[model samples]
Each structure stands twice: as structure tokens, then as C-alpha cells.
Target: MRILGCSDICSIFTRKKKINTASESQLARCLSTLDLTALGIGSTLGVGVYVLAGSVSRDTAGPAVIISFAIAALASMIAGLCYAEFGARVPRAGSAYVYSYVTMGEFVAFLIGWTLILEYVIGSASVVRGLSTYVDALFNNSMRNAFKSAAHIDISHLSSYPDFFAFGVTILFSAALAFGAKESSLANNIFTVANLSVVIFVVIAGAFKADPANWNTHPPCTDEDCKQGKGGFAPYGIAGIISGAATCFYGFIGFDCVATTGEEARNPQKSIPIAIVASLSVVFLAYFGVSVVLTMVLPYYEQNPDAPFPHLFDKIGWEWAKWLVSLGAICGLCSSLLGAMYPLPRVIYAMASDGLIFKWMGKVNPRFHTPLMGTLSAGLLTGVLAAIFELNQLVNMMSIGTLLAYSIVAACVLILRYEESEVSEKKNDNTALTASSVLKLIINANKTTHATKLSARLVTSLVFLYFILCVCFTSLVARFTHDINNLEMWIIVPMIFLIISLVTVLFCIYLQPVSGTRLTFSVPLVPFLPALSILINVYLMMMLDIMTWVRFGVWMIVGLLIYFFYGVRHSDISVRKISMKSIRLDGRKNVDSPKFT
Candidate 1:
């Protein structure tokens, strides 16, 4: 009668259980291509570009802030390609969580699912926090007054409340999430479209203001200017650009979130991949142009935390622009919040299907088809976090979790490819074919060849190598370059969260390996690509101050408690299910499927 920690929960989640793989509940797939793309933009695009871009440009790398965005975008794109292919093949709900369960094991999936909470729930509230801080800045006489008033909302329940304006905003969204994805998607469509329109207009309108001289203002640094402008190209040079890129990584956190909705989307196979790639491409252009303009008009050195973006508007004597920008930011962030809200609950619902969480939370609304209970829990959790936590620190933790997840997902694609190849090579000769068919032969051939047999070992080797590098970047690089005391107190907390989540994931993996899951292709050298992703991402995280690292700890503790107390018993995941549905990739019966939680 009493299910408690690992052992108790393990009984319910055991691999031996032979339950029905047939799903009872099916959700209506109402989203169109446009809706899906809009969801991507909703989660991506906002403050990361509009707000953070300016600060990095001003304070860190000046004009080269564009490079920072480019680097982060490039690294994300590598992982995104893998995400696209896998998401298309699977189209399930748990996103990386579900993907990991099938490909690596349950434990990895749990780690990913647990980390996703940091990425979305905490990340979404950070958006609200960003919105509030910006709004508060406008209402108060000065940015100083806004910072004081904006960081805390009056709540008897939680102390260290930041910004009441966003407090109401988060509450409104919590209720909205309860309604259904369609309603939220619909609201998101209207606001995000209008908001994006403003961005385009700003880009065009600001184009007229550019001084050709402005382009010349900061050239790629000669050693001379490094001494004058405090060194490097623009301000931070290549070095600063790297730092800015890491900091701005927070800005682009939501792009991968789009992949999470594979199950709910009408045509997830085609849609999820398209939207993920297209969304990031669009944001890249938008951010690059915006940063360029801000630097030209005011100069990045002139910008500081006091009034990062609005101060630029202030200089233009377009105080009205500040209001307009704020409106745009609110609209954009709401969409970001919407994109985030849409995927996470369904993941929990999916996790429940696997028997990882409370089964009660997995209930889907019969008519609306939303995972209402999961939605409510995620909303309540997010609202509380938004009401109390600081934005930058929380966002950093979100990035770390997200990067780790992305790196894993990307590596899976390669692993599965090699896995398939190796299996085929065992069945037949892999070396007889010409070099052309050699690669293509392995790729096209099924999982039964002597070559593919070698490929599996190759795949496993690369996966380990890539993961080690990712760990190094986050743990070693982030700690050494960015720490203040050189003690790295900030690193310890998130490590605990990461360690615990990974352990839970490891447990899940033991219950079920890739013995039964799908691996239909032959991929090559996954280690290099994933290692690149890890290196780039860790460098980015390192740029953030110690405070950001501290916030990551808080999120982990909360996620771990929820997983054990709730997710453990509810998830339908186990060794038996994996054995049964390892190759099953359909989306309709997906009504009962848990893709990512």
C-alpha cells in the first residue's frame, strides 16, 4: 500500500510487467503546419534576442555579438538536425525524455525528462520575470527604482518574490494552460504574429538610422584598439564574442522545445523537424540585425544593465518606442511561455503512461485532448518558481540542462545509425561494396551486416566519448574560466541535480536497454559532432556569473522530489514495454504514447 523511494517505486516500474501496450485514450491532432511553426516561434525569438542581445553587444563583444549569436546558433543547429530526424521518426511526447528511453535506456530518459523541467518550466517563468522587469522599468522614474520594485511581488507564501507584474502574468498563464493547447496556441498565434510584425518593422525602420560610419565604429580588433576600446574587435573581441554567445545561449533556449510536441502535432514526422530548423533560422536573422542596429546608434560600450534596450530607445528620443518595444516583448514572451507550456505536460502525461509519475496526472481531457492534470501541475510549479526566482540564474540552469539534453539527442542519431549498420554487418559482408555503395549501402541496408556489427561498437565508443566531452565543458570549462572565488561553489548545486537525475536515468536504463527500441539507420562518427556541441555549450555557460549557477541547484532539488514522489509510480515505462514497442513509431495510437516526459 505504501510506495516510497527507489525500491518501492521500482516494483511498479519493473521491466517484467506485461501490461497492454494498446492505448485507451487518443488525442485530437488539431495543429496545422502554421500552428506548429508558430509554436516554435512562440518558444524561441523573444527576450533572448531583443533583450539579451543588446546587453551583450553593449557590454561584451560590441559588433561581434553577432558572432556570439552565430556560434550558439551553429552549435544548436548541429543538435537540431539530429533532433529533426529522430523526432520525425518517433513523433512522440516526451521529446528527449522519450527519445532517451527508447534509444539509451529509461534512466537517461528520466534524466532528460527531469532536466526538461528546468529547461521549460523554470525557463518560462524566467520569461515572465523578464517581462515584469522590463515593464517595471518603464513605470518607474528610473531603471534603479524599477530593479528595486520589480524583483519581488508581495506574496505572504513565498519570500524573495521578484516583480509583481509578472506574478499576475504567470497566474494568468497557469489558468490558460488548463484550458487546452488549442486555446493557448490560438492566443499565442495572435500575439506572436503581432509581436513578430513589430520586430520586422523595427529592423526596417532602424535600417535608416544606421551610420555607415557606425559599421566602421568597431572593426575586428587590431591590437591597437584592444588597448583603446578595452581591447578586441568591438569590445570583447573574439574572446568576448565567445562569452556573449554563452550568455545569450539563454535567449535561444526554446527552439528545441518545439520537438517536444511531436505526439500532439497533426503530422509530427514532417512538422516537428521543419519548425525546429525554420524557427532557429528566423531568430538568427532577427537577432543579428537587431544587435547590429543597437550598437550603431548608441554604441555597445554605452549600454549597461541599468536600461539595456530602452536606453537605446531613449537615445533615439523615441520614448514611445520604449512603450512599443515593451508591448512587443510582452507579446513575444507570452508566446514563448505558450510554446513552453504546450510540450511539458504532455511529457508528464507520457511519463505517466510509462508509470514514472502519478497516474492521476496523466489523465487526458476526453473532449479537449489536453493532458489537463499534468498541465495544472506544471503550471502551479512554474507559477511559484516565477513568483520567487531570479531570471538570469534560472535561465543558466535551463541552458545547462537543455544543452546536455540536446547533446544526448544528437548522439543518439549517430548511435542508432551505427547500431543498425553493425547489426547488418553481422548478417552479411560489409566490405565487398565499392566506397560509394559502401557508405550508402550501409545506410540503406537493414540492421544485418558484418559492417554494421562494427558500426555498433563504433557507435557505442563515440557516444561515450561525446558525453565525456560534454561533461568536461559544463564541469571543467564553466568552472575554471568563469568562477569568482575560483572555488566554484555555484557548480556544485547543479552537479547534484545533474548527478541525481542521471542516477534516476541510469536506473531506468537498466530496466530497459536499446534491445527492443528502434534503430533503423547507419550513422557515422557521432562523437565528434556531439563533442563540438558540448564544447560550444559549456563555453557559453561559463560566461555567466556565479549567481546563475546557484539558481540551477534550486531547480534540481525540486525536480528530484517531484520525480520520486510522483513520477516514479505513475510512469508506464519499463523493460517489458520497451521490449514490446521498441520498433513502434506510429503517432495515432500515440494518443496513449508518452513521447518525452
Candidate 2:
């Protein structure tokens, strides 16, 4: 009856989901480490391997695109570690959503789950669209032209014609997932192996044709191109390489799909972390090798953006290799499509089972033991999106959701690392806070409930401060990138603030006692590693264009509305709390009454 009160509202929104309750998953634990690794590789090594190397080399970093991929890979690995630690600790289906619920609270969890749905939908749709286009091109664009001739619409954001092929592919994959988890993963493993084989072939074959001079020579350039820093290994200079790293960062986005299988992983504690690290290493090598061969085989300026590998083979008159590479690209895209769709339904099921969304969506199929309804729903939505939307319009919207999720996961890792566990909380509650006591605790650096609590608060505040400082520093650098040699007061002031913020964070993290709770896998350098992950993820998020922020803001607004209207009222945590309170009040009243006996 009093649920609408301000206190009640705050309690419901801020309540954290218990890890014990969340670990009781209905899904079957069928996935091995290799299966999970395949998911990561399949998801991450998709269209990017085939297309990204050539495009970034030609336009952004030139031969230095190899360095760009390496930088991006490093950043991705840091974020991947954060995910791995949480996966080992929580071992749930929702990935960041479940991690946040146990660490951050309910509302934040719902928002993350919502954002993940957005990321998967857009990512899968875009990949399917790309696959359709590739297949169409291979057949001389006959399919696309036929669709264009049949029913062309002149909408701005929508495609010129409906992409039925993309829609069909999405449905087909969704059905495979609904049939069973192991079945889908088996298919993913097959396609992933094929994809990797193609990458190896490309690297080995391209090596014989590679000319070292391509890296050293400045392809004939106009005066404007020269002035823009075009020439040599880094035709666009350090600035271009950094810019290309930002673009290449998206290529590494799919590795976190490994974390989403926490509920289904046969040995999540060890398997999830191993899969994340191993998969990331393999993906980085693939990207690094491909970029090297791509830039070396063809001059950066002459590289093709559309179908780089096939185009390279064509230029060299290697007709056989071109066909082989094309087959590999298709396999890669198919795997990526499956990888993207695989996680969406799992996140949905996690949210729904927690009563954050419709309960029916969380129901596991009796025979298949999969979230069949959720999978079908996700597939339908993704199919319709791929059918109507233009890829370019949808692509920019993908990274923001993922980056935000990564930042929050990293923050969660940092917070969880410093906070007292339940056992410690019971012990620490007895200690009273006083100025002298606080000072003594700080001076002693001994583990106490009070000291641990204080340290956690300090770490939380410092993390927020670090985020602000990163934003300021990144914005200032972007504004004055060209004039760095002639630094002004504006640049100097932000740089100092950023340095101080980071140093303070490090000091607080150093002094804090880490949580006693151990996991099979833990991120090395507690607080520091996760802290860096948060900073890097946020900085990359800021690198996105203004339009991306605008779209992200719109999505957040929609999620907020859903939370306040439906999630708040129907949440399992809220209902259980209310029922328990009512029962306690009734018992107290009976105790106060006269004894009937």
C-alpha cells in the first residue's frame, strides 16, 4: 500500500540482486572452454578481419594500421579481464547486467541489460546485412538489383529496398539457437575453424607477394595529402594511427560474448576466464597478421575498402585465391552473425527471470532447455531491422552501448574489489566512526570493518573523479591536438588535473584492503587494472561522434521509462520485500495481543 512512497521507491531501485539467488539458472550447462573460445573468435573475427585491415590502412593509419590493431587489442584485453573476473564470480547469463545487479543495484542492472539488447540487435542486423551484400556482390548484384526493381522505398534512414535475404538469414540462425545451445555452438565452431583457416591462407599466400618496399615508400601523393601527414609507414602520422585505433576498437567488440554464456558454461569459473583470454589472444593475432599482410601486399593508398582481400588477389591475378578468400569471408560473417545473436536471448532471459521484464520471455523450453521464446523474439526484431535499415546508419549506434556496458563492468569490478564481504560486514557494523578512530585506522593501515568501508567510499569517489578528469583531458586533447607543441594554459591545466586524479586513485587503491572473497580467476592488480579499464572505455566512448551520444541518450530515456513504469512495479525483489515486511508486522501484532491459550 505504501509502495509509492519516496523511501520505498528508493529501496526498490537501489536493492542489489543476491548472487546466490541469481546462480540458480535453468539453462543447461553444456558449453566447454573450446566452445566458448569459438564463440569469442566467431563473434570478434567477423567482417572486420576481411574488411577492416584494408580500409584503415588505405584511409586512416596506412601501414601503421598494424599498430592500430595492436593498440585496440590491448585495450580490449584489459576490458576482457574485467569481464572474466565477474564471470568467474557470478557465473550468470546476463554478462554485465548480472554483474552490475550483484554489485551496483537493480536499476543499473536493468539499464545494462537493456543496452546489451540494443548492442546485439544492431550488431547482428548489421552483420547479416553485410553478409547479404557480400553474397549479392558475388552473384553480380543480381539479387539486390531484383529487390531494388521490385519495391524501392526512398526513406532516409531505411534501405533503398527491403533486404529479404538478410532477414531470412537472421531467422535461420535464430531457429538454430532455439533448437538447442550445443547445436548452435557446434555450427559456430565449424564456421570459426573455417574462418581461421582462410585467415591463415591469406597470410601465408600473401607473404610471397608481399614487398617490403611498400612500407617504406611514400606512394605518390598530392601537396594536400603530404601536408596532412601522408607518407611512410604512418602516412597520417601518430594522429592517424590513434584515429585508426579508435575505428579498429569496434573490431574487438565481440569477445565479451564469452561472458554471456556463464550460466551455460560447463565450468564457468575456469572456462570463462580461459576462454576470454585465449580467444582475445587468438583474435589479436588474427587481426595483427591480416593487417600486416594487407598493408605489405598492396600499397596502403591502393588498398580496396569494400572487399580488400579478394581485391588484393584480383590485382595480383590470383583467381583461385580470390575465390577461396571470398568463401572464408562468408563463413566469418555467418559465425559473427550467430555470435551476435547468441547473447541477446540470454540477456533477455536473465532480465525476465528476475522480473525486470515480461516473465514469459524467461521461460526455458522443456525439450530444448533454451530460452526459446526470447530467442525467437530477438531473431524477429533483428530480422525486421536488417530488412529495412541501412547498415551505415545502424553501425554508428552499436559501439556506444558496448562501451557503456564495459565501463560499468569495470567500475563494478573496482567497487567489488574494495567492499567488505557479508562476513566482514557483520563484524564491521560494531565499530563506531569517530574522527580520532578514522585517523588511527588510516595511519595503521590495518584491516578493519570501518577502515574497509571508508576505503570503499574513497575508491568510489575517486573512480567518479577519474572519469571526469579523463573526459576533460580527452576533450582538451581533441581540441588542441594540432597545437600540442605550443601548449597553452588551457591544455596545461587539464593535464595537471588528470595526473593528480590518477595519482590519487592509485594511492587510495594501494591503501585499501581487497575483498577476502576469492574467485577461480581474478583480475591482476586489483583496482588498478579495473581502474585503467574504466578510464580507457570511457575515453573511447568520448571519441564517438555527437550523433552517437544523441542516439544513446534517446535509448537511455526509453530504458528509464520502462524501469520506472513496469520494472519498478513488477520487480521480484520489490514484491518479496513487501511480502516479508507484511508477515513480520502481523507476527509482531500477534505477539503484542493477549494469549488466547
Candidate 3:
């Protein structure tokens, strides 16, 4: 193998590959836009509505959890547009992985595929663990003890007990996937519809049961002691709403699952975008409506973590509604698990087929024509993880993976668009002049366009601006609220950042471009929207605790080791290097052409 150097690293990061949109013989294109939309709804609506609604309200945001959901939805919408553009352009499996490969390169692609495992596999495991909690509520603790005793597994001495139901659900869904895509879609559709019905019922029921007294925006809390203890609309103040938005980001995680279904989607370019947007909009409204009524139905303090909806019904003396709500949660969770697990195998299959993993992992079952081996492997691994570990840390780790991937995808969109604009300008110049004269024409423009120069500088300034502003805001808030000796030092950083930010802003204003290339189906405001998306994702990622960052770093290290030792040796790029090799970004290869290196 050839040793890589600085140029090679730059090439890997900067060079783009043609998208692989060839129809695979193994996977069927049977999913419609509605089917894709249902998937988005199914994957996202389960745990957020059933579990997180009350938990976040009780612990963090109180009645302002509605704002949290709204904030998260806005961030997801911004990221969703980027996903839509790529999905439309590529129409391939491996969502961000394929996008990065075509626009970023193989190494970045590998990292994205690795990060996606956290989003899909570990994410599914987290969902399964959540499912078990609801299952325990439905069956009572008796069922859990029965399974433990029957299996001769005694973890009574441990801090937390194992969840066998979670393990069983993972295996069950793996079997469903092995059966085929058509079957899985049918089940998903049925369960998703049921989940929707449940959400609607909760909203309607809670509306009728709502008490005006429960809608207090302020409830006699001015100090830290009352803010930390009480459960009113603004009990924890503005900070709680912001923190809740970061936490509620998990609710918006599922809409991107539609991107992973490109290989199987009919008219993927249209379907993926529609499904992502439509599903996110639907879920946001549902979550917002349910949250509004939930707080009004019961004080945030009295909400149950596992069965908040049912508890609301029971509170109103409607035993029938309580059971009905529980049943809906079960269906919702089952569909969510199905949606979560569906993408993992396909992602592994995409990577394996590219020779980044064991080749056998790419094999499709003859009868089902799906990635059976990968499905089973993903299932067993998630089952074990869900069974053995507590999911609080795992869920936190999952969110970090999500934010990291979103940031990369946003960057990819900006880079790819910029490259396209360059290509357009080159073509326009060539068309207007003869090839010999084109070289002498001198183009006369700056090497970097004004927009490009400003964007680069603005992004850099924003990063510093973000940290500094955050520090200033926190320190200023702390100075008034708590005991802090070095308030002046804390204030200084923000002041410096503010000055730098103002200078950069003025510079950008002065250097605005006269005209730029426009993208078809592109994100509005080009660099600004994509840049903001990245900044927001990074901010939320920073809000995650230190241990989550540690876990994420460890995961990245493992991915790097696998890539260096296994992927680099077996990758298709490596094999092509031994013969004639040249990658064309224009979707056609000229192997006889000279290599860039």
C-alpha cells in the first residue's frame, strides 16, 4: 500500500466522487412517498411523545417544553432541506455516507458510516430500551421477574436489572426485516397509523380535561431554590427552554431516516424530500398539540415518565382511556423500533459492498433479497447492548453522533454547491470564447469570489463569536444569580468576541457579491442557511455533558482503527489503484486518464 501524505489527505477531503445511483438487483424499489412519510413519522413519534414529553416537563422545561419541541423542529427543518437536496441529487442508499463519499471522499465517508451506526444501531438499542420501560409498565413488574427467573439470570445485585423484553423486540424486528421489505413496510404502516391515532386521542382527551389554573407562566419562583424544585410554566426560566430544545432534539431524529431509504424509494428525489418535510411537520404539530394539552391536563410535577398519557386519563377517572393510551404507546414503540432498526442493515450493506467491511456482510438473502446477514448482526448486537446497559449515556452518545453527522452533511451541501457553481462559471466562460483565446482572456476576477471569501471568514468569526457570546451570557447571568469572584474576567472574553464579530460582520457587508450561481432545489440563502445549520448543531452538541463527549471520542477512535487496519486495505479505491484509476466527479469514469497524485 502507498503511504499517504499531506496532499493525499487534502485530496481525500477536497476531491468529489460521482454519485452511485445504479439500481441494485437485490433491493426492491417498492416504497412510495406516503410509505416513506409513514416511516419518518413512525421512527420519530414514539418515545418523544410517550416518554420524553412528561420527563422533560417534570425535570427541565415544565410547560415550556412546547417551545423546546418547536425549537428542535426548526433546527431539524434547516438540516432537512440539506438532506432533501442531497437525496434528490444522489438518490442512493447510505444517506450521509454516500453524500460524503461523492462530495467529501472515502475517508470521510467511512467516518460518516461509522457515526451512522451510532444513530441507527445504538439509536435503535436506545429505543428498544425505552420500549422495555413501557412494556414493563404494561405488563407490570411481575412479567420482568418471571422472565429473569425463567432464564436463570439473576442480576438482583446489580445497580440496574437487565431488560429481556428489549432484547426480544430487537430479535423480533430482525426477523421481520429478514422476511422482506414489503412485509416490514406493511407492519410499519399499520403501527404508524395506530401511533397517530394515539397522539390525536391524547390531544383531544387532554383538551377536555385541561384546567385553566394549570397554565401558569409564572408561579411564585424568583430564586434558585424554587426554580429547581417547582413545576410551573417558567419554573426554571429561559435557560430551561433552551436546554429542553437541546434535549428534545432527539424527537426530530427520525425524519432523516427517509434519506436512508433512497434505494428502495420510488422517485426518490421527490419522495425523500416530501417525506422528510411532511413527516417532520406532522410530528411537530402533533408533539406541540399534545404538549399544550398535557401541561394543561396535569401539573408538570405530577406527570409520569413512562405512561404520562394514561396517567392523565386515570386522573380524570377514565379507566378505559388509560388502557387505550397504554395500548397506543405499545404500538407506537413497536413501530419506532422497526423504523430505527430498518436502516442499520442497509447502511452496513452499503459500506460492505464498497469493500469497507467484510464482503460477506454485503450478501443479500436470495429469497428476501435484503441484507439478512447485516440485519441479524445489527439485531444481536443492539439486543445485547439494550439488555445489558442503561440507556441514559447511550442516548446522549446517540445525540452527539446525530449532531456531528448533521454538521458534516451541511458542510457537504455547501462544498458541493460551491463546486457546482465553479463548474458552471467555467462552462460559461468556455462557451463564450474559443479554447485558445479562453486561456488568454485572463478571467479578470479575483481568485476567490467575494461571497466565498466572506463565507470562510464569517464562519471562522462565528465560531469564536459563539463561544465568547455563550461565556458572556453565562457569566453575566451567573454574576447576578450566583456567587462568582472572577465576573470581570468572564465578561472580558465576550467583549473581545463582540468586537471581533462586529469587524467581521462589517467586512462581510462590504464584500457582498454582485451575483452568484443558483442551485436547483437548493437551500435558501445558500451559505447563510447551511452555515447557521452547522452552528446550531454544534451549539447543541456543545450543550451535551462531558461524558457524552468522551463516549463519542472513544467511538471515533474505534472507527479510525477499523478504517486504518481493515477498510483501507479492502476498499475499492485501494483495488483500483493497482490498475488504471481515475474518479470523475461528473458521474462517468475515464480510467485511462492520469491520476491526480
Total clashes in model 3, counting residue pairs 3 or more apart in sequence or in different chains: 0
Scored by lDDT, the top model is 2
Per-residue error (Å), model 2, residue 368: 0.5
Candidate 3 lDDT tens digits, 388-474 = 776776778778777778887887776655442332334333334556543322232333343333333334444345445544444
Give every collision pair in model 2.
231-235
lDDT of 2 by residue, 223-338 (tens): 76564245789988888899999899999999889999988999899999999999999999999998889888888888898789988998889998888998999999999999
183 Cα displacement, candidate 1 (Å) = 2.3
Worst 10 residues of 3 by lDDT: 438-447
lDDT (Cα atoms) of all candidates against the true structure = 0.65, 0.86, 0.75
Candidate 3 similarity to native, TM-score: 0.83
Candidates in order, TM-scores: namely 0.75, 0.94, 0.83
Of the candidates numbered 1 and 2, which has the greater TM-score value?
2
Off by over 4 Å in 1: 1-25, 141-165, 218-233, 304-309, 421-423, 427-458, 473-528, 538-597
RMSD of each: 10.4, 2.5, 6.9
